[model samples]
Target: MASVADNLTMALRKQIGAKLNVLLLRFFDQNKSGEILSRVTNDLDKITETLQTGLLKLLVAIGTIVGSLAVMFYYDVLLTIIFLVFMAICIIITRMLAGKNLKYAAFRQETLGTLTGIVEEYYTGRNVIKAYNHEKESMEQVCANTELNRKATQKADFLTNSVNPLIRLITRLSQAVIAVIAGTSMLKGTMSVGVVQAFFQYVNQTAEPLTQASYMINTIQSALASAERTFELLDSEEEIADTKTPVVLNRAKGTISFEHVSFGYDSSKLLMKDISFTVKPGQKIAVVGSTGAGKTTLINLLMRFYEVNSGKILVDGISSVDMTRQGLRQNFGMVLQDTWLFGGTIAENIAYGKPDATREEIVAAAKAAKVDYFIRTMPQGYDTMLDNEGGNLSVGQRQLLTIARVFLCNPPILILDEATSSVDTRTEKEINKAMQELMNGRTSFVIAHRLSTIRDADIILFMENGNIIEQGNHQELLIGNCETGLQA
Candidate 1:
């Protein structure tokens, strides 16, 4: 029974966990990942722990108590009635204490979730802490969260423990009452001594179930609290549903146009308004602007990572909203400023998109990204294993690996967000040459702050605040000759 309940609990956790992950990607804010992880791990564990014993124990206890009651009434009705009064009193006392136990259980679970979030944040940001010499501050913050968790746990345990002793006291008092009543009935000749002794045996047997019920009460409360937390994540709003028959884009020619697009992270404050742009099928469009000029935001909108507020973005000739997100994203290849590499062999990371790519193809892509020579120098070459986050490689090398992935994908459209930002001067030149090859006959959006990187772009968009104020070729913008409303 315990094993079956465990399996059921694990299955529930998995289903809810999957739903939470989808919510994390689609709607939940990124800052809540730690909180979500807590629910998925610690809270789910609590639920499983409670369910492992709580359900079976509860059912067995209830069954035993019911059977015992039937036997007691058959043996002697008056004695049974006297025992019933004591049971009623015990129940009333337990009912009074149940609410307090549940409240503490909930508090403990909430505090644990917060503590988990603190731990996650501290560990992930440990590097930043060391770099900034903020170890004392971070430690203090951790200590504070841990202390809060400790107090909550202590209080919850206290309340849960209090119930068992109170129940045991009630059981003892009921047994004493039964003893006196049984003795009186024996002396009054209304009941035989053997029958009175049999009733006493039944009362003793009934205590086992009552004891089990008291112990499990705490477990049930804790489990419900944890289950509530899990369900909250599961019931969260899902992503905006895709069209029932969304168009599937294939073999795309990336002619992109933004038609008076407007958006904001918060509805109260519009971040980008009346943004409009168009790119030919094979043009290299450079988006250059100061920090907070909405350069990345534009790419986000184009990728449908977040939907536009007021206008439509069209790919080729179809509204992007009409295309399935998977189909739409598959048409474009992205190489971002921050490189991400999972724990795998060098070749596997390179072949992430084209999982079935041949070794020759992986090596060719690595060569094109200018990291093939470095890979060869490693201990195991392309078979070298990378740690989580590719800690074994330099930042520049990691960036190159990501670029190599884009080279392998060779999608119709490309988004390069500071692709060469982490590379040395010589390596940047090499990557630029390789990127030029990759960009050929493909629509490309290059986001960069360095003038030299985008100098040869067919179009340059100069943005300020939330609006694109000036746009033209690099030379035209350099000479301030464009007739746009604002000067470059």
Candidate 2:
């Protein structure tokens, strides 16, 4: 039974993980990592515990209770009736306690999830917390959450543990009353001494099973609360399904058009309304705007990470919706402001997008990104193993490594989302030259705050409040600056 339970739990955990992997990005935005983690680990463990022991014990207790009742009824009907009256009272009380137990158990699980989210948030931002000297504040927040969890756990445990003793008390009282009535019958010569003894033995059997059943039922109720949480996660919204027959784009010419595009994270509140833009193949498009001006959102729409609320995004004259997300995304390469690296060798990290890349191809790409010299300085060079998130490397190095990944991919369309923001000025200039060569024929979208980096772009787009307010070549925008007071 234990082995079977383990296998079942393993399958459940795997299903939960697979569901999370396919859930829409909005789900992640709304939930905390630690809360999700708690559901996957702690809640699943509760279910497993119930399956391994509580379920088995409850089944046995039920069987014993039924069998014992049959023998008692056969011995004496009057005494059986007396015993059942007290058992009914016990059942009513246990039922009441079980309901309360489930409620408190759910509350306890919720508080635990909150506490986990708090701890995970603080831990991930520990460096910022310390830099700002907010250690005391962080600790206080954790303690407050912990106290909530403690109180909830106390209430749940009180309800769960109290049920056993309460039911036992009621059963013992029933046993005492039955014993008194049986004694009177024995004295009146209506019952044999041996029959009275046997009835008392049966009473003991039934009473013990009743106590055990009450306790196990409460435990099972608590586990059910956990199962509820796990199922909730498994039932979250997932990404839109792929097309039945998707347009396969092995290679794209990189002509993109946004035809009256309108979108918002929330469908009811449109952020970008009636926005339209077009990019010819091999053209350089620079997107510039203040923070929250929908620059990144535009990129997200183009990549189909979040679908547009209303509009058609066309790539190479075909509606992107007609293409599989993977097929559509395959033609574009993106390097974001934030860099991500895993625990692996430097070469492995660079080859992540194309796992079967040769070492020579990896080295050539690194050199083009101006990170080859730095990689060689490491003790094991490209073979050096990086810790989680590449903690051993400087921020600039990490950014360069990501850039190298994009360089190797060499997609027809490139998105550089403040990709060079982390490097020094000299390195930025060098990367700009390399990027210029990279963009010579491929369509590129450059999102940058620095005006100097995009002065030579083929066309510049200035966005505000999710709309493109101005767009022209660098010189045209400058020439119109006096009229519109536009500043790039």
Candidate 3:
């Protein structure tokens, strides 16, 4: 039974992990990571414990009760009937307590999930909290969550622990009444002392298991609450299924167009309405906007990270919806402001985009991105092991490694979303020089707040309130030649 329970738990964890992987980005946006993690970890542990011990104990208690009752009946049918009446009362009381136990157990789990979310948030933002001198506020918030969890847990434990003693009290009273009746029969010479003693032995046997069974049942009920939460996550909606026969784009020519594209994080309130734009092959398009002007949203739509509500995005003149997501994304290389590095050798991090890259190829890509010298200066050079997120390297160094990763892929299209924002002016100029050579024959989309960096872009798109307000080359925008109301 223990082995079966363990294997089942492992299978369930794997299934939940797989489901989370395919779920849409919207699901993640709506749910807290820590809450989801609690369901997968703590709740599953509760289920495993119940299955391994509580379930087995309950089964044994049931067998013992049955066997004891059989012997009691053979010894004296009248006494057995009386005993069963008392057992029925015990069952009714236990059923009532079990119902309350389940309610408290569910409450306990919910509070635990909330507490987990609070802790996770505070831990990740500890640096910001300290910088802003908000440590006291953070501590208070965590304490409040912890208090709620404590109350919920206390209530649930009280119910579970109280069941066994309550059932035992009822059994003891029933035994007292039975003892009186047997003693009277013995005094009247109608029942033998040996029979009376033997009957009491069976009575004890039945009562003991009844007590154990009641406690185990309550414990199992708590686990059932946890199981319900796990099932909720499994039942969450998944991403829309891929087409039966998706269009395959092996090597796109990097022509992208957004025709009447409309979208919103919430479908009812469209953020980008009837937005249309087109880009030719090998053109540099710069998207410039204030905060929350939907620059990133446009890129997200192009990459199909979030689906459009009422229009089409085309890659190489083919509707992107018809193409496999992998096929569409593989043709575009992205370097974001936030660099992500794992615990691995520097060579492995550089070769992330092209896992099978040769050592010579990795070095070449690093050199193109202007990070090869830094790599060589490290104690182990390309083989140096990086901690999580490359903690040993400065932010600029990490950004350069991510840039090198994109260089290795050499995709048909490139996306640089504040890619140079973290680096110094000298490093930024170096990256820009390398980027110019890299964008020679490939389409590129640059999302930037630093307007000077995109001065030479083939076209500039000025967006506001999710609409393209003005667009032209830098010189045209500056000279006001396109006749748009706004100028650069």
List runs of model 1 lying over 4 Å from the truth: 24-30, 475-488
lDDT by residue (tens digit), candidate 1, 173-241: 889988887888789988898998888999998886887786787668888888888888778876566
Best of the two (1, 3) by TM-score: 1
TM-score computed on alpha carbons, candidate 3? 0.93
Best by TM-score: 2
Give the per-residue lDDT digits (tens) of candidate 3, residues 1-488.
89988998999999998999778889889988999989999899999988899888899999999999999999999998989999999899889999999899999999999989889888888899999999999999989989999999999999999998899999999999999999999999999999999999999989999999999989988789999999999999887777779999998898988899999999889899888888899999999878788888888988899999988999999998898889899999999888999999999999998999999999999999999999999999999999876989999999999999999999999999889888998988888889989988999999876656558788888888887877778887878744543343
Two-way TM-score contest, 1 vs 2, winner: 2
After superposing candidate 3, which stretches have Cα over 4 Å from the reference?
A: 74-76, 184-198, 475-488
Q: Is candidate 1 or candidate 3 better by lDDT?
A: 3
Looking at model 1, report the run of 10 residues with the lowest lDDT sum.
479-488
> How well does each candidate superpose onto the true structure, as a TM-score?
0.94, 0.95, 0.93
TM-score of 2: 0.95
Candidate 2 per-residue C-alpha lDDT over 36-137 given as tens digits, one digit per residue, 9 for 90 to 100: 999999888988888798878888999999999999999999999999999899888888888898899888999999999999999999999999999999
Alpha-carbon shift of residue 306 in model 2 (angstroms): 1.2
Model 2: runs farther than 4 Å from truth? 481-488
Question: Could you give the candidate ranking by TM-score, starting with the highest?
Answer: 2, 1, 3
lDDT computed for candidate 1: 0.85
User: Candidate 3: global Cα-lDDT?
Assistant: 0.90
